[model samples]
Target: MSIQVGDRVPEVTLKRLREGLETIDTYTLFDGRKVVLFAVPGAFTPTCSARHLPGYVEHFNDFRSRGIEVFCMAVNDPFVMQAWAKTQSVPDGLQMLSDGNGEFTRALGLEMDASSSGMGIRSRRFALYVEDGIVRASFIEEPGQFEVSSAEYVLEHLPG
Candidate 1:
């Protein structure tokens, strides 16, 4: 089943480009912290670049002020994730996570077959509000939909 509110995130490794390529586990990343984790099918896509990603970027401080960390994930490699970060002028506060092999995405039951679009296996658009490794809320979008998983929606729901 796909993850839900109150579910513990699956233990899996994801890549991020910091000073260099750094490997991080979902277990560690969400441990003892309030995190807003958002996922997209792929990075650099139209909707993703135009609104999804930028929404998070623009709301970095909104999350931070609430003591939450923001994470953006995609089914792309670390290199592409890093490049998109730069392309979007993402700051240091928002982390770009890469589910390179889609293992993490599959583990969370959020993988989508995008082979017809030449995107191969990808992540469904979703966001999770996690605290101390347990989900506080989960906003998963329907296929080809962008109605629920935006930063504005997450912000509206975060504990004040």
Candidate 2:
């Protein structure tokens, strides 16, 4: 089933690139914190790289100012994600998480197969406001849609 607002995030270990190799789990990463986790189709796609990811990057400070940690996730390897993060100049505070095998995406029921587009398994565009590993809010884009998952939308939904 698709993850919902009140559901606990599934436990999973994901690789994250740091000075050296590092690992993190869903619960540990988000437990006891309000996190804004947004997923895109792939790491370096056109609209994703130019608009989706950049929107979050541009608003990283704003999100943090509201006490929400921002994370960008995609079904690409950590190495590719690291390169993309550098290319986009992603600040240290804005995390780039690699769901390389799509395990996390699939566990959340957000997996999308884009083999027709030669992208393989990817994630549908969505954003979630998670607190202590439970989803507080979820914004899912309709097929071929983008507005709802934008950073501005997530910002507007932040609990006052």
Cα shift from native, residue 89, model 2 (Å): 1.2
Q: In candidate 2, what are the lDDT values of residues 68-132, reduced to their tens digit?
A: 99999999899998999999999998888989888999999998879999989999999999988
Candidate 2 TM-score to native: 0.97
Model 2 accuracy (lDDT, Cα): 0.90
Q: What lDDT would each prediction earn against the true structure? A: 0.93, 0.90
Model 2: how far is 30 from its true place, Å?
0.7
- Residue-wise lDDT of candidate 1 within 1-160, one digit each (tens)? 8987778999999999989999999888999999999999999999999999999999889889888999999999999999999999898979899999999999889999999999999999999999999988889999999978999998997765
TM-score of 1: 0.97
What are the models' TM-scores? 0.97, 0.97
- Candidate with top lDDT is 1
Candidate 1 ranges beyond 4 A from true positions: none
